[model samples]
Target: MNGNESAPRDAAPRVVVGVDGSPSSGAALRWAVQQAGLIGGAVDAVSAWEPPVAYGWNAPVVDTSLDEENARRLFTDELREVLGEECPVQVHPRLVLGNPAAVLLDAAVGAELLVVGSRGRGGFARALLGSVSQQCALHATCPVVIVRAE
Candidate 1:
């Protein structure tokens, strides 16, 4: 290769995957890794969280700093569990605080693809009920892929 020529991977596509530390999300993460490898691309592991209600039913507001840290831990653990310590393609872990659908759509702005789990509800039927994957499929600028756990 000539020095003037750039590497193919330098312009590789970016695949964004939503990970919520669930079994379905683990499957989605695996799928993202494989897809990224196939296209010589990278994966953006995006995890979103809110104030939590702050959890249970109408519970009191908890410390947000701790919540953020816990979210990061979950994100890291999920990645490690799914892709292990070493992954074939580059995997960027992103933790954001917002609606899952909004977070994913924002991340997918310039991405080559956006991936999310079926959340046990498959197809357009889930859209009627308003799932994150459906919101992504309908609004993402790039292609959206909904993966289901094995």
Candidate 2:
């Protein structure tokens, strides 16, 4: 299917949201949860992380497997904390390794909507869309929503 194509009308749609433990991402997660409740669907909170690469005459001497694991645990725990037990909908937390934009776009396949925060650590202007948000908006298989922190 094309990137902009919506899901089939008869299917039970899923909502995917990117969360990074930031305030903005937290807002996005909350928004996505509400939207899922309204639509009678479940929410998938995705967190993506990639190890830093060292550039030099080195043979990739850096190991980030443990770091990635810790980050995944932390992100999942934070998401669960933010989405308290009183939340009205089901939330599934996922942690993956890759570029954030690519990961979200891939997850958007067969989803009803892709949600992300407006601004992130990247050097994007706060007044406008951040890089990851813009990328997902442009490339997601379904409609994309950008939630900005209040």
Candidate 3:
């Protein structure tokens, strides 16, 4: 090691982005990838899905294991297809069974940035931001970037 050649001070940071198969999320993914290139960081694509619930007059039941697995597969496939093989940075796919906001917030705990879509499949049409995006922006430990839908 030569004293004249100092170690590179700029280290790659970890970036986490949440996806839900929506066009808005696709934009977020693209944005994250670009940011990763600028910072020489890796991107982790995360998705959260819960099982459908059956509501009855007598009882309500929910089983999410299968749904979670399906979600994982979907997210993985999408990442591979959308990101393609030419991307320079590393990409990781993650899927969990829970509320989207909660899962994203948890993953953001140690990340340098958390990226999300501006809107999702929510009922409210006039809201500026989707519930998940708003929640993450408010509660995430890292910086939150919301990519608006085209």
* Best candidate (score: TM-score): 2
lDDT of each: 0.80, 0.82, 0.81
Error of 2 at 141 (Å): 1.2
- Worst-scoring 10-residue span by lDDT in model 2: 1-10
Residue 81 lDDT, candidate 3, scale 0-100: 72
Q: Give lDDT for model 2.
A: 0.82
TM-score of each: 0.80, 0.85, 0.84
Rank the candidate models, highest lDDT first: 2, 3, 1
Per-residue lDDT for 1-150 in model 1, tens only?
221222254567889999997667889999999999999898888888876555556667667798899889878887888888789999878888888888888888777889898782333543533388778889999998888778
Per-residue CA lDDT of model 2 for 1-150, tens digit only, reads: 232343466755679999987678989999999999899988878888888877768576557888788888889687878887677887767787889999888878888899999887565454487889988988887899999887
Q: List the pairs of residues colliding in candidate 3.
A: none
* Error in Å for residue 106 of model 3: 0.5
Regions more than 4 Å wrong, model 2? 1-11, 124-127
What is candidate 3's local distance difference test score?
0.81
Clashing pairs for model 2 are none
